[model samples]
Target: MQSELILKKDVDLHHSQDPYRVQNADEIDEDQSIERQLRFVLNRLTPENFQKLVINLINLPLNTQERLNTAVNIIYQNALNEELYSHLYAQACKLMSQIKVPFEHVSSKFISFLSILLKKCEKEFDTDYHKDKYYEYLVKEAEFVTDEQKRKQLLDQANEQLEKAKQNYIGNVSFLAELYNMDLLDDAILHEGIKRLFEKQEKDEENLECLCKLLTRVGPKFDNYKNKEKIDDYFEHLRDIYEKRFSISARIRFMILNLIELRENNWTPRHESGPKRIEEIRNQVLAEREERELRFAQTVPQTQIEFMVADGRRYSLFYGYAHHILDQLKYREDFDRVLGYILKVDPDRHSELFEALICISMDKSDQQRDLIGEFFYQNLKSKVFKLDQFKMGLRKVLLKALESYMKGYKFPKKLSQILANLIRLDFLDISFLKDAFEPVKRDQLCARIMAKTLKLAAEQIGCQNVSDIFELSGLDFNYFFENFENEVDRRDFFKEMRIEWVSTIHEHQRQSVELIQSFKEKLEVIFRETGEEPLAVLDRIEPEFHKEETKTKEFIRALSVVFFEKVLHHKRIDSDKFKKMENILVNFVKEHLDLQLEMLYSVQVLAFHMKYETNFLPVSFMLLYSDEIVERKAFFKWMNNPRGKGHGIAQVFLSSFFEHISRPQTEK
Candidate 1:
């Protein structure tokens, strides 16, 4: 009977004038329209009766299965009719949410029917009031799906449907918290989707990326989220890795930056107790050995396993007993051996550990007063072994240790000498010294260090003095300004050394003149031909120079005055001479006259002016302007009415008044 019915339905479908008419058996839109109508019929069913129907549909034969799927799609389409869509949409949502739909065919058809209802609701109600109910159905659909591909497909479809329906969702922190608990979405997708989902709620879920982004966005508001426990939890994992290495290196630099930057992190256990808290951090890290360590066992990359194992063992041993081990060793031999192992294995992080230890010792000098400086000095020396690139870090550590030592004792002569030499060696990095020594009468110390460093650097390189040091160091003239201040002392020092002091360097004056000449030569060659009338020919066949020698000399002299004297500040050229040169360049015509003139004159002048202000001249041209001239000129007039000034207005005015005006009548 089912086969007979299916044959008739197939014939009827083929004859039907619908867009979903099947060309082949599998090509029908069974889910979109047909199943919708069937679901409507199913919804008219009583709950117990509908459950029985779904159960019977599970055991149906292949032909019967196709017929039932067709009927469900038909019901789905029927629900979209004005009379039936809402009723069926509500019914389908209720049925799908209640008991798990056992059969994939029935479940798939029901989900399609529900989706149609959602669209219909959106169309009719013109709001997403129905979206929460719709999303609830999708989540239910994800749980009941049996086939993996179908499960994934259904989950993906559900998520997309939820996204479209998101505006209708109840945006609240509670909603996101519930969604996370459900775990229906992948971590990355959930991260973004939940952010959108809860954006209207004005509450962001505090995850790693979200926290970092939040910290960046609400920069000053970070104090609100700066919970000590939260920060402890964050570093709690890496505390073992951090402290075991025993050096304040770049590894934890950003973490420390964050800790120092955020006001609430200022009260962290690591900040409070220093090395002792680091021991607690190590203990916390070791606690992860069984639970967290085995998580990577299956997925550990084959090439990294051996390396990771060795590192893990060393890290574990150092972290597990660093406090007890470091304490038992009263002598240098034991400390050096342990420090050597850490430095050799992973040098980057050992520095942070060392810094933490130093902070601890600096804070607790009363307990073990005499040993702190020696321990710090020995560790500082060990950390730098075989690492030439970290000389700067070494310098900082040495300076820090010196400051710590100064807090407790009288200045020992031998130690002071060693400290002085280290400071002098790194005098060029004066910024570090400034940071380390700014708290005391270190300016005198700074001057002594500077004088000593410059003298030593000069001698080491076979030079005579500080000036020779700069010259032989291949530093540019700016180096003097960079190192020395514009103070009376620096001025006196320069004078004592018999060195020249100028406001700027006319570094490119010759090049500026030569560049103008190159452009002039190019233009002259283009117009070198003869037999053109000067006054009669607007379109000239020869060069525009009236009697070549007179024009060339006038052009060169005027250009040289502007290029060399006025611009380069060799000596001030007469203002009338500069104006004449500017007018000459502005009036000259070639294929691209404006561009060529700009290239030859204005750009060269601009380059010269940039050189003069930046390197050579103490006073700028703008600074030298007269208020009377500015008040009289059209330049200020146009500046006051920029929009009213027509396009190319400045150029037109320059051409009309400046370029075309005849000079004063003198002795012709």
Candidate 2:
């Protein structure tokens, strides 16, 4: 689906004016207003169920470090769109402050994101440099460049760097210089670099290519330096040995350029015939080179190969070692003809084809992403492309496409097939699952790939690989356990998913159903007696729980476990029924369980824990039990009244006295 079309439907998603109410969505009952707020965001933002990742983030309480890290990454992804950016950012800002965790402990990426927004608000565009941030951003940008030509293009961006560097960047010039010097052959501007290279005595000999390139850049400048013969001798010696790495045309061009340089400087050579001889050589080389390029551009030669010789006589063949031959072209028609011929003739070399496409695409001034991607689809689709050895194409291609699409970029051709291939090769991991799932909804190939991957992942060994399966499932355990409007709906979905997951992950071994059936019958009567009211009616029971209900069976057991089970441990005596009842309410608060009863339960826990938790009892329970005399009466009076204290019925329960309390924490 196109983004505009999906967004058009987003326009019609009528939301209630009252954001606070939760009307049972898909049979789920959530009390908080944020559930509606979240649903509203997800419906419009997510195009399909696969892309409903905002669902998982919003569904969980964002109180853990791991969840917060995921939130920050999602913030980075959503920042590509202005509308989604504003919404995700606003929610994160609110949650970050609400969580009240330490700022330093959180992911620095999130802190930096918020800092960018804050700076925008304050109208401070210049960010303060700290923690190698500027250099990191530079390296990130550098990852986009591929070969020597691209690096040269980056290096010559000295003008842009000079502008950005005025505001206190470290090693700004050196950074640009590094990219400029990477794999340099022809010396377009190497006079200063050559000077720098010779300044160091213990030079790395392998880097002597820079010296040869320096001669090419500054050879013309030697006339101005007043030691023409000495410099000429030095460069001519270096050229004979090292300049074969450069093209014959590039060498000849330098010679022609040196002649042009002499004329520009109006050099009166000490030998009268020297100037005339140099001019003749320049014209001859230019005419011959032009004729040769015109032929090569019109028709490519077969059985031609580049070679590097080492160990006195041995040679290694160089295929696609140089596209510099074509890059030097002055006419687009000529370049296009040769490029087309090379793709047709040299289809076997994938890297060279990619290089050719990238180089051509980079040279274009308009719509490069679309143009390059379209050309690939039309021309290279027959070549059976696979990801590169290191899998760098996943980042360089698919992710770049995704980022561009989110920013509302339209491609010249739909890239879904290539995108699907990358995903099938495991390029997109779980972290990228949410971000990739949305816009890729349009790409049927990718959608099919995702569905197949998740299906296989469901039955993987040890269930460790099944994390992706569960995450893709998007089924919340707590939602199934407690937050349903219809009891049958909740029970059915919970039972079905639980059984399916357990059996699959455990290799077709279902849990013992007969034992749970026997257990459920014993447990149901007790559960039915304890109604869903504030205080459990403690007139009924004893120390009645069958066992500890510890880790193993707690998760995989039958749904009957939570029915009558409250968190409190109980005893039988009638005198202690109130104690068991009070203990029941307190335990709910401590466990933070069962939303329907949590609010009423918390008031009792806080009130009781405040009075007896320190040493002993409140004044209502006993004057002998009172730990403090000066304010016990006032505390009870303040806790009971509606106008100033609290609600009527709940406060009455909170202020109730218990003759006995549970064991101490240290004893436990």
Candidate 3:
């Protein structure tokens, strides 16, 4: 009866409906039965039972070597479906390898398994081929389907299968890593697998991701192996791929970066601790305990805190904390939080904090300087710190900067930006400007700081304000220029100051001022060389109108004023010269239709300003209208809605001018 039961169990295993079962169980041979039994045992493998399961596998009917080969293949094929148990499968193989088998060892069988897996990965990583096959199958299957929705369903099914294939490929690569980790397979097999992956011509993001996972798993082991140099070369190749391969997705690139960082940190993760040995874990615990003790020692008693403050040790504490805060500051966005910490710790020690901030700002980049300035401005506005503290800090920092400059360290321009911010925030009085220049004659370093400070200050405050401050301080500009060592520096300083003066005007007028200056230079050259009347010289110097219509009109209006002045001085408004000038002006207006109204308005301005000098308004109107330079419609438009309402041109002159143009053709 027991023999019948054993036979019944074998028959049940043979006739079972499992996919790995033979199609015809009745014709199952003895070897097939042994293979089926092996599969059944491996299917139930767990970490606790893996060793016993390896014994059962060894005690099979087949020879020892055949049993090892058959067990390795079954375990590998089962692991592909049970990815979470891959390490268990590897351990089962390792146990079998240690059993002192007669014919062949399980390690050799694992190498065979790895070779099979690498080939499978090569095929699986060829996603293009699988993708093409999927589309081809879809086309063939949906060829006769009339409905679009049905065809789409078939296509979706194919896509699902393709995705499943890709996941299976990744699972196989991970299994290889597990086998390598368990020491069942050597580094050469793992290296071959990685080499095959890298040598593949079409490495999609998924394939590269598989490579990253493989390296992430077994990479650290390779570092200590004999092939460390080869592993380094592989890493170098990965870096090359990351930089040059733009087609890789950002997510995959990030994974590659993480893998590289993992290797760089000696296989330790950045944010989390990796698996640690017993000694390492013990060391970590001891270190943490020591850190807790250090924190306890760092705590100051309330009475001691008061004593420290009374004894002036608070300066040391504040300076240390301030320097630490500056060192850790990475971005401007952290300024508010940093200030809050400072306030919470020692709010009354504003002077020390300010001095520390200024010193660091001078030593760092311009952005750091700007951030510090913004910090000061915000605290001042909130009344968090006294304005007097900031001023005192600035004086101290400036002295230090002067000393550094005297030592041949080139002065940092960013210091001036801090000064500018202080002046703009009213934390520093304009008198500070006068005091900054007090030692200009006595010291070259002071002169350099004063020049840079004044230039930046003028840019922040108005140039007029700076000039007024200088005048009130009794500081002479010529004296400042004479103190400079070279002529070029003096000239550059003068030119920059002049530019700052022009920059202080309204943006609209600023452009007009610059164009007016440029036109004056050209006109002077013409006047000096040709010696013609104002209108003739105006005709000679061609006006390069601005592309913007408003600016061009401004230029025309300004030119009209200068030319009118010249006409008055030379008194050369004869008919022939006036006609020539009129023709030139008319051509300018014609080239820009938008400027026609501007020309008419310019004439009105000239008439308004020189009303007492001559009655050329009517003559100018007739010339413009007769030349068709200013369209009659445009002239009417200007008369209805005129610009420059503050010019105070008389209404009667305009009306009479209009009446004169309205007269009949033969009215003489």
Candidate 4:
């Protein structure tokens, strides 16, 4: 079965193998290129024609002919798939010693097959040729990987290579570009690369482009970056070098991203340049969307409405641009616009979509975020027809918000406080009391809601576990202060509100009640003498003694810190006008000595010193600190009585204070 190997005008087989061939396979003579020659054989891939091509490839001598080498490369690239290329690579390896073709050009032809060897080469890249090829193949294949760990491993190895190259790396741009494109969790390599990028004195456009790509990948993953401080520092560096390095388009895009990073950090763009470029980015990005105004009108736009609603059709476009809309809405708190957007969107959309969007948009750790969510919940109770539909969105948003807490996310202290206020203000519904998700948060929420109701009277608002005012015998000055306005109610309201809080034989309760009444009586006279409001307009934030606004009435108000420790912790009533008030205190006790009113005033004095939280000497000439007046022993003895907590707590507090004040002022 020997066929004559006639030279084909279209195909180029070596004359020895060319000596035997089939007739129809050798027809075309127009093309001269080697790639075209191989493509011709690609067209006639019958079993017999395939046999001839393989036999020729096996029999032909490997030589330095560029045309022949190129034809092999083309065949490898065009017809030899990864499997066949792998099979043929053994032969190519043998032929490489004899052929003069550039290996990179030929190696690239079987790139997918060649990539399998890169991991081995990267591990022991002792030779320059192997290191170069390892980087070459890694750059080509990195785009196809999506596994976080695998990508991380590859980046770690590549960064190691870059480290070996030190400050002057020719392939740095290529290696960094590939690393930038990969999605991974380990940020070590990335953080290091970005640091070195800024540290280098001179940078070209390529370096700048690579940096932008890295930043874009890192920007949205704000929740994932454990070290938020580094993220902030990176943005600060970017802002500093922006005008000098980045182009106008790059600046626009970067500033917009920077603003988002700011929002995630519970902040807004602080710099003037940030705001200006944000305006430019807003206009430019929106203008591009505006180009398709007719398409949006033709049918509902496919674009998802998000924090930035730029199209003007579906989105209200808060502040007329999408630039800093998210953070601005957060800062200004335009809840109506948020509600309006929800109302205007497709009524048929699943409610969770809007719910997730609104919740994720907020910095849940920020207290201000609670106020916005509170606004949504409070408005849900309205009788208005328009607000009725918001029930689902409102409910879903709250559940989603609570779900975060269930996942072990802690609310900030401020947020925890605001939650109590909102719940107390009737901002939540009771039906959610049964969501068995986070019992702790549920109990906390319910406890707060009930506390507002139990605040006035001693009855349980709804929950049995929540404390009732009656249980504490109305000895709670806080509850009594807000609820029992008159002295009779102070003395008598507990028996009427909840009898369980009362004990007829508890004489300790009797004297404590008497003290509270006496303090209130004295406080009223002090209030009258000082007038209702102070005439002086002192800066409320400054320490009372440091203030220059000295008015007689204001000094008395300053003195109110005694009973209202929680209210006026820092106030000092040391003005000359307060001397008359001290005389009143001395004379009042003289008048009420038969009633034994001295203990009540001593207890009141202890309350003020307690507010400072320091064990140091009291800063003002307050009564409790005066050693000449031995009221400390009296207060300690009264605390031992059943009216207050006994167990040497008063002795411990005074001892701690005296010990602290005894130290050197500098040490204290």
Q: How many residue pairs clash in all the candidates, one count each?
A: 32, 2, 0, 3
lDDT of 3: 0.60
Best lDDT goes to which candidate?
3
**438-476 per-residue lDDT for model 1 (tens digits):** 333233333333344444333322122233223323433
Show the colliding residue pairs in model 3: none
Q: lDDT: which is higher, 2 or 4?
A: 4
Give me the overall lDDT of model 4: 0.39
Arrange candidates by TM-score, highest first: which order? 3, 4, 1, 2
Candidate lDDT scores, in order, read 0.36, 0.36, 0.60, 0.39
TM-scores, all models, native as reference: 0.22, 0.22, 0.33, 0.23
544, model 4: CA deviation in Å?
33
Off by over 4 Å in 2: 1-102, 105-112, 117-503, 506-517, 529-543, 546-668
lDDT tens digits, residue span 1-668, model 3: 98989876735335556557437877987777899888888877764344335656756664455655565567667777787788777666555554433335433232333344345545644445455566578767877788999988987887777776667778788887877887767877778878877876254667788899889878777678588888888889889988999888899889899999999899987775445544345445644654464355458564443212311223234444454455444444577667765665555566666776777556554545655666776677567777666656655666665566522444536566565554441222244444444444455555555556667666554454455444433555555446667777766765754543422323433445666566656655665565645456545655433445323665566555554444443432455655545554554566565678766666665564443235566666666777676777676677656354212233335566666554444652
The candidate, 3 or 4, that scores higher on lDDT is 3
What is candidate 2's lDDT per residue for 1-668, written digit by digit as tens? 79979777746667888777654665564324444454455445421221234434444554444444444444433432333224234444433432322244632222333333333322211232332445455555666778867766555564345434332221222222322333211233334344444443123332243343334333343444555555565556445534453433455445534544444455433344413333235444644664465456446453453333222321212222223322322222244544443434334454544543343333232223233333333333333343341133223343444454422322322332222222221112223333334444344323333333333333221132243223333432232134345657545643543433422343322345465565456445544666633244323323544324312232113221332134223311132333333443233223322321223222323333232232222322333123221133344443333221112322334344421222222433
- Compared with the true structure, the alpha-carbon lDDT of candidate 1 equals 0.36
Global lDDT for candidate 2?
0.36
